[model samples]
Target chain A: MRVVYDGTFEGFLTIVYELYYQKLKPTVIEKSALSYSLFDEVDTLVTDETKALKVLQGLQKWWSRKNLQTILNTFMCDSKSFEMDLLKFIRLGFKDEKELQNINHTSVFAIRNLEKEFFRHYHRMTGFVRFQELEDETLYAKIEGKFNTLYYLGEHFSKRFNNQKFIIHDIERGLAFVHNQESKGIHQVADFDEPIYSSKEEKFLKLWKTFFKSVAIESRTNPKLQQSFVPLIYRTYMSEFG
Target chain B: MKKDIYTKMQILSDSAKYDVSCSSSGSDNNYKTGELGATENSGICHTFTADGRCVSLLKVLLTNYCIYDCAYCMNRVGNDIPRAAFSPKELADITINFYKRNYIEGLFLSSGIIYSEDHTMELILKTLRLLRHEHKFNGYIHVKLIPGSDAKLIDEVVKLASRVSSNIELPSNKSLKLLAPNKTKEKVLQPLKLARDISLERTDKVIGMSTQLIVGATPESDRDILQLSSALYDKALLKRVYYSAYIPVNNHKNLPALVNKPPLLREHRLYQADWLLRFYGFNWSEIVNEANPNLDEELDPKTFWALNNLHLFPIEINQASKEELIRIPGIGVRGAYKIIAARRFKRLGFDDLKKLRVSLKRARYFITCRGKYQNEVALYPEKIRYALLEPAKPKQPTLFDINYSATTGEL
Candidate 1:
């Protein structure tokens, strides 16, 4: 038997809700698999916010706040064998309150490692995501992230860049997080126009460039060390590098 | 008549780069009252410069004018360099603009002593006040505390700045006397001790002071440096001590020649030892003492210690306590905790450890999986040391050598 739902984490939780109430014993769970055995039964469910909420509330009762948060964060990671492993992890957690402490368990161990990688991705992009002033004074930044961290950045920057109108577009996924200090939205777009620069934008950029250049000690120049910090993968989006 | 921001930034930051305390971690001072920028406790490094240093803060001096000529300093009063000073308004303006565009995490304001220590500190305070009160910018502000400045001024600085440090440049008292006549041990330690006491009095959980120690500038051994650091941490409640391998910036008779390059690996070793002191539950006496004055350049401080004390090794992976687990080579603080947590659920073996991504190259020799030693290498310390030795690389450090980052056993 196969189980399927929308790719969102909440969708996965909605499936988790079915797994308990409906007594599902799925051989496989996925956002959508291209193929399933013809004889295999397929159970498809749309994402239900209420069902997800119930699953979350049930988890809160069983698990510590930290473990529950880890569950959500690990789910953010789209690892291979992800859906089945998460299902096993959740099942084990349900069986024992101390399951996450059992880091030797394969499913628990995998989720824990993915949690680290997920946070590393989230933190790096949040730090490296550089904002520029647009003509009308909207702070705009872009990131070509390997993870779906655009949503995370929205919450972070909205608090960090208080009262500032801003938009952070992940051009790779054609997704943008727009915040107006009071409200926030994540929108998908096919294309985005290059923003017009503010009058002082050029001057500030030049000053930043000068600071970057002058701060580096000439004798201590280590391109490889610099490479480790600002890797090739992130250079395209960052203004300091090419 | 006014110098542009670019010229001031270049000159000021170039002078400021030598004091190498780039960390903007801990202390939740930012974002409580700021409309412009927030210093997330986990600070951001927007970029890394060519020297491979983190560009987290706008690390710059307010002015290069100095009343004291410290021999190791580039901004020494004797050096005939281009001089400029930022009006408090100018520095604050530059900081806000760069911060808005997310070029930096916050401002690291350092300055050369001019007129008096009070005058220099007041200028820094003016800049901080403008950012924190006027602009409502509550980002991470790391200010340099003037040694002989007024107690009231230092107290005000402690309250305002997120973190503070007074650089003790050279390691020993004699070296300070030889190189920097204007500075004394009490001159540096007094302000740091005051800041620590002030922060302690206000918030019991607070750690607000650090100092930078210069390596290779003088003949002070690693033992001397680590001893100083350990004492500062224990006695004065010093939070951190940054060791900058002496990169000769000035041509004073007292200082080393420019030809002797920055002791990059030695500095790397000191940092490794410092990490052991702070996190790995190791003491200075245990890591370095009378017998071994310098850290072994070939092996890391931990590996060196492990080799020296082979009797303690072969700690059972499944059964060892947290203290025993951390002492084993290659198992960092995090790795040790991971082992402790995992062993309750399952008896961890070589396979389980491998799956957890623990660095077992050196660890396999010292640790046993279910009382079974994992490595083919003999239990004898000499044999294990030879087996563990990484194939030697050239001594001459380059601009891009990536080997300097030996994990100071992950925090």
Candidate 2:
């Protein structure tokens, strides 16, 4: 019997229990769009709230709550071979609690990969995020990142600029959060239209461009090194470079 | 005009190439209004060059015009070289433009003495001040302290720069007198002492200081170099002491006739010995003696120290403390921590050591794991010396270098 899920963690956990309790053989569980076989019988599994909670509660005894959340998030990201790896990890979790702590195991590969990707994005944003001053006397930034790391990045930027009102626009994902003077809040915007620049801002940017041109040592001008830090693709959006 | 610029650049860059400490780290400054950009304490590694050097900062000299004539320096007054000077505005603009394109972490500005020591120091300080105040650039800046600059100028420079260093070109006073008559030991050490004192006083700021010593310039022994470096570290609280191997550039009557190249391997050995002093807690007397001033070029400094002190060997890895682990060859601070953490979970055997990627070739002679190992090496005093010193066959070249023609497929 083949089972189809709604591509959610709860639905997948319910399918795991159905396979175990019903003692079914030749079972395959897949997301909705992944179903292509003509001969197999497909039963679409609905997300059962109570059964999913029971399975998660049982998993908490073997793995820490944080580790379970990491595994679930990694699965929701739609990684390759995630279902098979999750199944193996769940099996190992039943066998020995110590197996959950081993990071090098194939079962925990998705969690480890997600952590690496998170740190990479965090470091890149640390260097690449540029803020521009708008005509309304507010600071603004735009980033087009692959991961949904805006909340974590917002917390970092909040700590960096506590007294300023700024907005970070996710150009690729079409989401932005406006942090006002008093508190920080998230908002979704359709797209960014270029804000009007004031005369003072234009003058300051001109002065900045002049200073940038002056500070580079002609003796040590290496474009190859420059390309490594801010790649050519990012140059089009950068004010000084443009 | 462009050819002249290129020529001056080549001369100045070649002159400034020897000083190795170019790290722009451990500071936090944000771009304010009118400034080009800002800096972060978490330093950026801009790029690695063809020579495997990390090009982090725009390391350059303000001018290639010197008053003093150091025999080993290409920019010495007697050498025939083109010279160039950038106005403070020019320097500030270049830094801003390069920073905007993300070419470098920041600026590491040095200079050949233009006129008087005070005049040169003031010019460099003005450039940095303009970059900070006028340009609003809060970036990593490392400035070189001219040997005879006024104490007040050094103080002002330190406030604007992230890190400061003074080059003590030769280790001893005798070598400084013979090669560079204008520079004395006291002149070089005085400004460094003032910078160190000020940095200590302003502990809240991100202050880092370092020094550089030219190796193989004169006949000063490696023992003298290590002793001086150790004193600088202990007394001056220096972050690093760079060793630059002397490259002959000027022809002078007082210098030795050209015979052999500068001993790069010897310089490398001194760097290792310096690292041992700084990180491994090994004293100079333990590593070197009065008679033998040079380190063994074939083996590393830590191995040499371990070979000399055989009585302290065969330490139990799991049971030994962190201090004892640091003394063993091939075991760094990180390796010791790994051993400590791994042993908490399971009893570490030879297999576990292999898994941790510890260098078994050198470390096997020094450590015992579960009180046993496979091979039985020499334990006797005389036999162990021969075993450590025996020449081994060279291994094949790495895959990165091998089959160059086939990989490139050049017709």
Candidate 3:
């Protein structure tokens, strides 16, 4: 049997709940739905909030809150085999009746590595988000990150820019995290036209570019080392790079 | 020079680029709702420069004019470089704008001795006052303390800025006399010492204090530099000791000739040993003795120490304590904890250790799996030393200034 979830923790937990309750063995668990599969019985799970919460509380009994966050980080890695990996990890945790992450198990190790990979990208995005001021004084930025990191960055940025109005669009995913000081929401933005910047925006951009270029020591110029710290993909939206 | 903000920023930032303390990690200043900025505990690097240095803050000098002719300084009074100064208003404006756009975490303000030490310091104070009170910018600010500034001024600096540092570029008083006749070891450390005492007395959030030591500049050994740092940490005067490879910017007869490149590899090795001192629970005397005053360029300090004391090694991986575990090569503080945690579930064999991400390459020679050595290299010190030699890395010829030397005042 195949299980399709809604690409969320709650959805994945609902599938886990049904897997235990119905005693169904799933060969493939994924976020995408297949079109008209003849051989395999495909089950699409509607995210049941009660079942998801129950599963979460069950996991909490065996693991600390920090370990639970690690599991969420593993899911956020968005790896091809993350669903199966997390499933095996959850099973191992219940069977062992202890924290499986510290157990030196293969499945646990794989989940931990994926968690590290996800945090690495998320941390880089926190540094590289370059916001330009729009005409109405709203800070605007666009990102095309590798994973669904939009969910994790909202709280960090909201706390940092608490009083400012800003819109950060995950351009590749067609989603925008809009914050207007008091209220914030993640909306599916189908048509985000090129924005008109504030009058002082150009002047500050020019000054920043000048400071960036001049700060590099001539004798210590190494493009290779610079490239290693910041890869080409993250530099796409950075104003100082070009 | 009658310069625009653009021209002044370029010159001032270029002048201040040599001050290689780019860390913004120490302070997490609480942010009010309508405040201009907030601080991250693990400070964000907005961008990496072409030199591969972290551009965390808008590092710039308040002014580049000087009256003293320090032999190693690029902005010495005698040098014919273009001079510029940012008025208090201009600097505060730039910091606010940059923080507003998320281009920088905050400002790193340094200046030369313009007119006098107090005069230059007061100019820096003016800028910080505007940034703190006028603009309410609560981001992480790292201001360079001019060595001989007044105690009152230092208190004001601690109040406004999130982090402060005074560069003791010359490692010793003898070297100070040779290169910078105006500066002494006492003068350089006075403000840092006073600031620490005041922070403790007032029970305020004692900000991070740091100093820079220019490696391969004078005839100071790694032992000498680390001893000074260890003493500073003992007195609680310094949270960090930055090792900048001596970039020969000036040509004085007393200083090293300008032909040699900055000791990048030696600087890199010192940084490795600095970690051992601060985090790995190694002392300066253990790291280097009178027999070997300098760090070995070929092997890291930890490997060198392990080779020197072969009797301690081949520590049982499963049974060794945390201190003994960190002594083995290729196993860091985190790796040691992983070993301790994983071994509780089962006895960790070589394959199981590999699963835990421990490199058995350098570690195999130093560690044994339940009294059974993994490698057949015979566990001889000289033979293991020959086998464990790191392949020399090709020099990048660029500044890879990553300092992991800060500890309590955490990493």
Candidate 4:
């Protein structure tokens, strides 16, 4: 049997809720928008918050807090067949709840690997994300991330830049994290206009570029080493690379 | 005037890059006072430059003008290079501005001795005063304590900065006399010892003290370097001892003339040994003794040691303690912990070790899973050494290589 659900994480949890109640053994799972193939028996699961909540509560009861967080982070990954992979993990998780903690398990290992990849990108963005000073003294930065990491980045920036107002726009994802002093908001930005830089911003950037150039030792200029640390894709928005 | 900052920054940062200590870790001071930034214990690398070096701290010299002429230094008084100095206000402004833009984690402020050691230290202290007291900037600030500076100035500098270091340029006293005439081993150790005492006495604001050693510049062996590092760590509570492979920056009759490139591989080997000293519970004698002063270029220090002492190998993976596991070449500090935690549930095989992040190919020859050897390779020291020395493939960056580069400020 094939199960189709909305792409949201809530939709995935509703499928987990159906596994216990409706006795639906799904052979394949696909997101609703991409579910075009005809199936002999098809179950399209509508996302119900109550059903999702029950599934989450059951996970907390049987699994662990870390496991729940791992699944949530895994859902945020942009890998192909990630939804189907999540379904496999959820099924195996409820089958033998204790097996969820075992790193040797194929499903648990796959989800944890996704979590590690997501967190690595998230942490790298935290350091690589540079803000340009706007004309109104607000800081504006944009990132094109592989995962939906803007959710984790907001807390880090808010705590660090408490006195400042800033907006971190995820260009590819079309989401922006707008942070003001003491309050933060995440909005879906349809179109973000080019930012106006402060007069001092350009000079600081020039000085930064100079500093970056000077700090590298000419005797040990290894491009391959540099590329390994700061991957080629991340240089697009980094001012130092320019 | 605005362009002057860039020009001066070029000279200052270029002169500063030779000192290979750009870590912003070891201290965990969160932004408690509504300051603009916070410091993580694991540290953060803002960016990596073309040299693959981490751009963590805004490593810069306050001034390239000096009174003493160190033979190995680019900014020595005798050298005919362009010299520049940043005023206290200019440096403090630059550090704060850079921090605001997330260009750096903190400021690593070092300077050449001008007029006197005390005078240079006072200028650095003033910059720290402005950042800490005036701007209330509570981010990571690593300052260089002038070797022969007054104790009062050292105390003041230590109180303001989050981390401090006094570069013991060359390892031995003979090398110090031959290269740096004005500085001595006692002068360098005095400040490091004082800073350690002061940091221990202070109840608030934890401070970490570190020092740098110029490797391959002098006639000091790896044993000599590691012994010095071990002493500094044990006696003065030095948090880190950085080793920079000598890059011939200036022509000097006293310095070692290198025809080839810098001793980066040798420097890398020293770092591996240094890691064993700090974390792996191995002493200087264990790493490199009087018989073998230099590390083998082919194998890593741990692998070399494992090969030298093959009698202890073929230990059961499940039965080995955490200490025994770490001594293995492939299992790092993290991998050792992972193995210890996972083996409690069931007996782990060679495949299980791979999942736990062990370097199975390297560990396979030494370790056995439940008394069953996974590989057909012999365990004899000569055969194992030759097997490891056989160049099978091009070197790819492993986790150990990344870990060493990150810890030792290598690209």
Candidate 5:
């Protein structure tokens, strides 16, 4: 069976419970609109607060509260092989509370790998994510990330520039958040079509690019290492490379 | 002078690139009223390159003109190569410009011997002093102490700089004579000892000293290197010891012909072993013996250590003390702490370890729950070694696996 969730963690947990009750082996559990499977029987699951809370309690019984939170973070972030590995972890969690502790050992190495990946991306974003000052004097940023890390990113940006008014847009996911000098909140927005950059913005980018190129040692150029650190995909948005 | 500066900077910096301990950590002090910039003690990490080398500082050389012809050094004076030297002012200007743009954290300046030991030392000291006093640059400066430099000069450089280092080049004095006749064991050791003593005396703003040794250069075994490192750590009070795998840059009658790449893997193993010695409560003798100078090419130092000490396996996860927990193959210092913190609230078993995300495959052989895996069939050391060393084949991804999106945007 294939299950389509509401792109929400609670909705996925509801599917987990449904699979357990029905004793059905799910071939795929994906977010709504993302599933393209035709052969498998698909069930669209709605978010159930009660059922989600029960699952969270069951997970807490076996694993410590902190570990359970990490697993939940993995699930919400939509980690690779999360569904299969999480199901196996849940099964083990029930057999022995110790089984949940051993989640690091399971064949599904996705969770730990995902944690490193997320932290690495987060670290890169700290340095690489650039904000441009608009004609209106408000800062704007456009990012193209594979994961829905907008919430976490907002927390970082808000703290980094406390007094500045800024808007960060996730172009791929079509989600964005705005933080003004007075208030801090996260809200979903439809597609944004902003005007082209002013001449001053273009000049600053050119200067930044020049500065970047000038600083690197030509003799010590290691393109392989540079590519490994900042992948070609991220180069699309980086002011120096783009 | 400008051309001299550029050529020398390129040669010396390129030569110094292989030395992996260029960290600019400790004490944060910025320029008050000078030309430009300041230093933050947290040590800014500008970027990590493909080879995983951190580019925090402007790692370069003051001159590539050397008096000693070390076989492993590309800039050896006898080698038929172009030479260059940077005046103190030229170097200071480049550092200031780079610092202002936030391209580097600080300057990591090393040099080849120019004119004499004292002369080369004076030039380096002059550049640093200008950067600090005249330029009022407060960034973390890691100056390389020239062996045979005057004690007073070394003391002055240490006071003006955040960190000072001198390369031992080779492990033993015998190897030093064979490869670099100009430099002896005392020549390298004296400067390092002087830096250590001065740093100890002035602990307020003084950062500690570090040293590097070339691996796979001579016949000295890994045991010899480790013993030397252990002594340096215990006696010299050195902050760090870096190992650079010998790359054959110069060919001479005295040097070995190019056969294989300077055992980069072996160099990496030594670093792992070094970490264990410093943090994991391991000793030099415990890691390698006289007969086995090198570590296993395949397994990490910790895994090798665990396999060698099999009798201590299957220590109860909940019961193992902090010291015993550190000995586990998969558990690091952080992992051990997590285990301790988690177990305090609940009785931890095999499943709990998985949830905690410890590398259980390596740890399983070394740990037990309720004395269960104590009498399990132990695999032959060769088989275990093969299993540990052999790289696993990449598994073909299933349709479901392919469809699954990675959380952090990485493939």
Candidate 6:
């Protein structure tokens, strides 16, 4: 049987609810946007807030809060098979008492690896996001990350630039995490035009670029090693690379 | 040359790059409600330079002008290089601006002494006061304390910065006198001890002290370096002891030739031995003794020790204590803890050990899981050593192998 739902995390929990209530084993768990085979029986699961919360509460009893968050972050991997993989992990989590903590299990290991990759990308974005001081005296940064990691990056930058207003725009996802002093929220911005940097901002960027270039030792020049640490893709957003 | 701020930054950062103590860890201060920055316990590397070194902090010198002509230093007084200095306001502004952009975790401010040690240190203190008070920036700041500076300056700077260091440039006292005539061993150690004492008394933001020692420049042995490091950790409560391989940045008859490589392998071995001394509870005497004065470059210190003392091998994994488990070559501190915790459920086998990420390729001869030997053959010390030294797998065959395989199908 094929199960389809919206792409949000709540949609995933709705599928888990159907798994227990309907007593069914889904052969394919996919988003509603994906096309299914004609021979397979398709069931589109609607996201019910109450049902999703109930399933989350049930999983909390057996698994840890960190484990539950890991499952949710693993769902954000954007791979084709990530949904079914997370479903298999949650089903295993519901079994014998200590099964969830067992790292030897393949399903558990798959979700753990997904969480690792997601956080790896998230942490890189925290460093790569370079904010420019706009003409209005606000800080702005734009990133094109591989995953939907703007929310996590937002929490880090918000706590840091608490007194100043800043905007972290995820160009690929068309979302911006805008924090104005004490108030912060995510807004959907369809297009972000070229930001205006004050003359002082441009000068600081030049100084930073100069420092980055000069700090490298001339004797031990290895581009391969540098690329291994900060890949070429992340450099596009960094001010030093510019 | 009339250098602008950008050119001055280029000169100062290039001068500061050789000091390889870029770590920003050991601070767990989160962002205050109205603060502009925060620090993580594990530290964050924003980028890596072309030399494969982490660029965690904005490592720069306040000036590249110096009075002391240290033979190994690039900014020595005798060198005919362009000199530049940053005003107190300039550095504080740069640090706050960079911290906002997430370009760095903090500022690692070191400076070449222009006139006197006290004068340079007071300039550094003025910059720190500007950052902490005027800017209200609460980020991690690691400043280097100038040796021979007054104790009052050291106390004030320690309270302002999150961490401080007084680099003992050379390991031995004789080397310090030979290469650095202006600096003595006592001058360096006095500030380090003062910082440690002041930090121990305070319960607030200050976190101990750290120091750096340059290797391969002097005739001091690795044994001497480790002995100094062990004492610093024991007596001074130093947070870290950085070992920088002596890169030939200048030419002097007293220093090594420019043709010689910068003893990078020896530097790496010293770091591994340092890790063992700090976390593995190893003493300097155990790692390097009076008889064996140098660490083995071919093998790590732990493995060499394990090979020398084979009578302690084949430690029972199920029954061994955590300390014994760590002494084994393959099990790290984390792996030892995992084994102790997991063994409470059931006796672990070889497969279970592999799941915990134990290095069984090296551990097989030394450890036995549940009394079942990984290698059933009679273990000879020389044979096991040779087998371990052999390459894990043969290098990928060249074009000749394809020709040989095509002709020798034997169909």
Question: What tens digits encode model 6's per-residue C-alpha lDDT throughout B1-411?
Answer: 678898889889999999888888888757888867888777789888877788989999999899998998999999998889989899999999888878898999999997889999999999999988888888889999998899999999988887889889899889988899988999888887888778778874346578889989988899999999999888745889999888888899888766455677788889999999999988888889888899987677888788878888889999999888998886789778777866776788999877766678778878888888866544666766776787657667786543211111111
The window of 10 residues in a row where model 3 chain A has the poorest summed lDDT is: A96-105
**DockQ (CA atoms), all models:** 0.55, 0.11, 0.53, 0.56, 0.08, 0.48
| 5 or 6, greater by TM-score | 6
The Cα error of candidate 2 at residue B90, in Å, is 1.3
Q: Which number leads on DockQ?
A: 4
In candidate 3, which residue ranges exceed 4 Å CA deviation? A1-11, A33-68, A95-97, B390-411
Tens digit of per-residue lDDT, candidate 4, span B190-218 = 88888888877886434687888888888
Candidate 1 vs 4: which has more lDDT: 1
- Model 3: per-residue lDDT, tens digit, A1-242? 88888888899998888879978688888797857568878987899999999999998887778777878778767644688878988887777647564657777877887887887888889889899999999999889877768877776677778778988899888998888856888889988679999999989999999999999987666666777789998999999986
Candidate order by lDDT, decreasing, is: 3, 1, 4, 6, 2, 5
Preferred candidate (lDDT higher): 4 or 6: 4
Scored against the true structure, residue B210 in model 2 reaches a CA lDDT of 86
Off by over 4 Å in 5: A1-122, A125-229, A232-242, B1-12, B26-44, B50-52, B204-206, B374-383, B386-411
**Of the true contacts between chains A and B, what fraction does model 1 have?**
0.73
Estimate the overall C-alpha local distance difference test score of candidate 3.
0.85
Candidate 1, residue A242: how far the Cα is off, in Å: 3.6
Q: Rank the candidates by TM-score, best first.
A: 4, 3, 6, 1, 2, 5
What lDDT would each prediction earn against the true structure? 0.84, 0.71, 0.85, 0.83, 0.70, 0.83
Best lDDT among the predictions, by candidate number: 3
Q: Write the per-residue lDDT of candidate 1 for residues B1-411, one digit (tens) a residue.
A: 678878988889888988788778886734542387777877777788888888889999999999997888888888999998889999899899888888888899999988999999999999999988898887788999999999999898898888899998888889999999999998888888888888889888655678899889899999999999999888856789999877777888887766556777788899999999998889999989799999998889999999889888789988888888888989988998888887777787898899887889889989999888964788998888888775767689788655544222111
**Residue B116, model 4, lDDT:** 88
lDDT of 1 by residue, A1-242 (tens): 78877788788888888888989888888777768788988888789999999988889897888888877776656544478878888998888867667877788887777778888988888778888898889999888866678878888887778868999988877889998846789989887678897898888888888888888887677776788777898888777774
Winning model by TM-score: 4
Tens digit of lDDT per residue, candidate 2, span B198-256? Answer: 87788854368888888876888888899889888887458789996665667887676
Q: Report iRMS (Å) of candidate 5.
A: 8.7
In model 1, state the lDDT of residue A208: 85
Tell me which of candidates 1 and 4 scores higher on TM-score. 4
